[model samples]
Target chain A: MTLILTALAATVTIVFRFAKQKTAEKLRLGLLALMYSGAALMWTVDGFAAMFAGEPFVELQNPSVVADDAFLGICVLFLGAAIWAVGLIFKKATKKAV
Target chain B: MACFVVPAAEAVVVAIVKKRADKAAKLQAEALACGGANAQTNTEQKARTKTHSGEKISISKKLGWLNAMLWGGTALLFLEHVWHGEVVFWPPFLTAAANPADTAAMLYEIATSGVAMAVLVTLVWAGMAIAADNISWVKAALCKQKEGANQ
Candidate 1:
């Protein structure tokens, strides 16, 4: 479900980026697409692994998978935020040039 | 140390950005002073009578707002997972629920997050409008100043 949501987010941002004229906005949108798409891909691989291995997909009882996924999602979110901050700098640059 | 180092780096970047912004604004004002801005320039007040109509919001602003909504929705979903005291990192989705009660809970969560995403998108759109308006106001002010000095 999280993966689906992340993928949806990626789609929305990428689609909207098409309409934007400014580079700064595009950069932020591109970063968002990268983050969400990456998270979604990670989850999809986890699902495939579970299917191949004949395991209950979620295995809520297993702290291992849950912990790992949560950690990864958090890391992705943080990384996205970091890139967004960098984009802010570029945004200022773009604004000045315009 | 990561926290300190990160902010310091960000601050330096921000300083550079601010300096550039001011310089750029001055340059644009100078350009407008040279007659880059004219009567035909888009404006909402004259839009009804004008052939091209008033200025439309830029794609960049729209995309920026959408990007914000995407992040907002993701954050809400993360919070929903944390609230359950367990992560649903893996998903058979409803099938993973062992009982009817668990299934109901899972469905409820999905519904809630779906609503949250919608709400976030709406809020972002409103914010974008306000920001766009502010930008226009600033531009109008700049145009007025340029015209005044010329007259």
Candidate 2:
């Protein structure tokens, strides 16, 4: 799950750099990437430490919690990315018309 | 985090505007130069003129405020953390340990990370402002080159 989130975040970050409209798309995608990667890194490191040390991870007992957190994180990331992408496309179209 | 984003965006916007203003200033200078104005005299006069003019006033003034706010807010947040200790909603598990040495390490890490992020964000903002200020010259040079080609 951590790896998934990290990958998603990194993907979004890369996409952000290439989508050059210099609009909100950049911010939305960049922030989404940062948030997802940050959360993923935080959770993955913590989760791994707990698993390796034979200790109970904070959200380990709640299988739903892990899924829920990851879901929410991904949702935010994707939503932000989509919004940014749409905005960029719209901006480009407008610029072309002008 | 949101606080940081606002300032960063503001910085970027300021930078863009500054670049535009710089381009305008440079074009004006080039136009003057093409008309046989003295290089040094025109530059000094342009500088004096800009100091009095309001062309780039918006960017400079807005960015100045943003810079102050970002740095000030970051400092206040850091001081708040120092006074109250780690104030994050979810303290990391390692930091939750009761051992004094472990706790100290965690606190140090948190403090260092916070400071580093704040500094990094502030620097980004500063760089944006500087870029905004200089971008005008870049744009002016490009425009002038284009114009020369047309001629």
Candidate 3:
């Protein structure tokens, strides 16, 4: 899972780098970023809930490990979404003026 | 490390996108400034409209929808996962519950799968954007070159 996520992150970064020239690309990249991050959050939360509800605490390897991971994931996801939102808003305001 | 990576990567992508936007805007301004005979040409008008329209659609409208869907879906799935405790849906309840390792495995599966999907989507979208931007630039440049040739 970690490997997959990392790969995806790398891919997204590269695409966004090339597409930066067009406003549409920015928005598309933003959207894609939000989607990926959001999905990550979902998986993290779900994983934790499943672990706590069904498995022994020892299975987690460390008690704080899962929670810490989830917390971090959520925070990052939120921040990305926020920035993307702001960009969208700016785009809109600019469009309205034109 | 994962935490740091995600945000840092996002920041970098955002920065690059911003730089591209700046360049495109500058090119546009230059095109406008060169307004003499070229500006009045049909091709010039079309290029101007196309670029602006592309910006409007890509950055403003499409982006808003993408962000909403991506973030909203993420939050919803996360909440559901938390609240429901990894049951996922109903049909597979028997299979889901039958295996003890299923929940953790499933979560892992989702986390990994979601990321992959996100990356794929991002790449495709970015590629399309780059192509469009280039096409516009090329069109404008060709028009200018044509005008020069005529003179």
Candidate 4:
């Protein structure tokens, strides 16, 4: 679930990038892109790991794995928020420069 | 244990970013102040306004993309998860069960995943708006470039 959600997030951003060419070219927005894409990648890897363990994204009975994934997904949200906050600060500082 | 890792990493990231932003702000302000006399201040202010608009355009563009990526991607992934039946709507997780523990779990789900879904939906709306607004500039730019090449 974590992987799937993050993957969708990544896809949305990519489509937005192409749809809005002018805005997509900025460096600050790159941080946002990185945050979502990075989280998606993490979830994808976790999914693969689950498959390796002979379960498709963990057996429904395994609360432990699901709990971990949920927590990780939450963490990814925080990380993305942090990156966004930093980017905004940077934007303000460079307001007149660029 | 690893849950703390993301927070720890974010703390460090925010701290470093704050320092850099502050330093840059101070330096840029100093340069602007010292590099010009009162007579040039008006021109500097004008320049600042120009850059401010430019910054707005830059930010709006990026914000649009961010909206699309985060919300859009999340939507797709969520739908996929639902289709896969990987989502467990158990007593403690998705609903307020008879037990207090289950109630807490239900609240947790409402707080996190529910909020995330709401946010994604909102961002998708905004992303569509911005993407639609900016679609024209791209076509214009391409057309102008082709015209220039032809001439």
Candidate 5:
């Protein structure tokens, strides 16, 4: 599920944020952590809401459905990375302009 | 439901604030330029403001970090909802709006899950901004200790 993927990404980013000093800060690892963790939080809330609505929080689905969910999750992951990349590019461009 | 809208809305507000801050910065820079230059003092002030990383970022820049997080998260969640057919390109947009019962449920989701996401992201960003600003202090202390050791 998307939740699990984002949560894992958040965990890894947070660890990198704290463990590495120079490279992590240069890469803005904290922003990446924020993106992933925010998605994970949103998904967590969605899961709880679904459960309250009498739906399974997460369930095994048809293979196609599962595949679609997996694909969507990957896309979400890439989207977050893309946003971070754009931010970095913007920052670099602004620095150059200055 | 349309849970992503909450953060998207917040992003809009933050964007306006950033714009105002940027305009103010620009005007201040212009004023500094117009005034007769105190080159030596200006250099001294710049040096005093410099962080270990070389520049002390402004409040606006800190807001930028939060804006990016909110916008990025909102986009991702919106995409996921669209993938599941909860959102559509048609009028009303939300699939849940077709039925009254579903509409109520969607509203509930927005009230709880949507608001929670916005609040949580903002809280995290607050913590991040505090840490980012304090990093200068921490690094400066360490540098001083290193200089002491050298002496």
Candidate 6:
């Protein structure tokens, strides 16, 4: 499920943030963690709802759906990284202007 | 289905809060500056000014970080829902709006999932603020910025 991957990404980001506080903070690692965690939280709700409805939380039998979710997980990861990068550039530009 | 709406709504509230916080920070800075004007020695005045303005980041700026997180994540989730056909460009916006039964389910999802996500995001932001407040590097950055300002 996308939730699984995004949650993993969030954990890794948080770990790396602690591992290198100075560089990681400059990269806005917390923002990336927030982004992944939001998606993970939503997907977690979806997972629970699915289980309550007598449906599997993840359709392992359906390779296509699994693949789709994996792709989406990667996309979300890249998108979050992109947003953080842009924010960094913008902050730098503003500091220069100031 | 409509889960993204909760965080999206929260983002609007956060933006407004950020605005007010910015104003408050500015006013506080001004008051500090005025108060420091009466300091006895030049060095004392400089120290007072540095300490006042040397905060690593303004409260409003930290709020802006939270806003960015909420808005960015919500926007992406909205697009994902749209891609899955859960959301639409129509009047009610959610595809579940067409059916009474499905609409109730959607409302349940919003109440549970949406509220949870929003709360979790806020909690994470609070944790981030607390962590940054304690981190030595963050303080060093604040001092460096103050040095730059003084120069």
Query: TM-score, each model?
Result: 0.33, 0.33, 0.32, 0.35, 0.75, 0.76
* Candidate scoring better on lDDT of 3 and 6: 6
- Which segments of model 5 are wrong by more than 4 Å? A14-31, A51-68, A85-98, B53-57, B135-151
lDDT for each candidate structure: 0.48, 0.46, 0.47, 0.49, 0.78, 0.76
How do the candidates rank by DockQ, highest first? Answer: 5, 6, 3, 2, 4, 1
Error of 4 at B75 (Å): 22
Question: Between the candidate structures 1 and 3, which one is better when assessed by TM-score?
Answer: 1
State residue A45's C-alpha deviation in candidate 3, in Å. 13
Model 2 residue-pair collision total:
4
Write the candidate numbers in order of decreasing lDDT: 5, 6, 4, 1, 3, 2
The candidate that achieves the highest TM-score relative to the unseen native structure: 6
What is candidate 4's lDDT per residue for B6-78, written digit by digit as tens? 3223334444655666677677768778766973597567655644332223333334444434443343344
Q: What is the DockQ of candidate 1?
A: 0.04
State the lDDT of candidate 5 residue by residue for B113-150, as single tens digits. Answer: 88988888888888867665567754454334333333
Question: Clashing pairs in model 2?
Answer: B15-B132, B19-B136, B22-B136, B23-B136
DockQ of each: 0.04, 0.09, 0.12, 0.07, 0.45, 0.35
Interface RMSD of each: 12.0, 10.6, 10.1, 9.8, 3.6, 3.2
Candidate ranking under TM-score, highest first, comes to 6, 5, 4, 2, 1, 3
* Higher-ranked by DockQ: 2 or 3: 3
Per-residue alpha-carbon lDDT of candidate 1 for residues A12-97, written as tens digits (9 for 90 to 100): 76676544525424355555664455345434444554566698655566687677656655554555556666766887798799
Q: Which residue pairs in candidate 3 have backbone atoms (N, alpha carbon, C) closer than 3 angstroms, thus clashing?
A: A24-B58
State the weakest 10-residue window (summed lDDT) of model 4 chain B.
B1-10
lDDT of 4: 0.49
Model 3, docking class: incorrect
Better of 2 and 5 by TM-score: 5
lDDT per residue as tens, model 6, A1-98: 67788889889986876676666656767677767776676677677778888999876778999998788777777777777788789988998999
| RMSD in Å for model 2 | 12.3
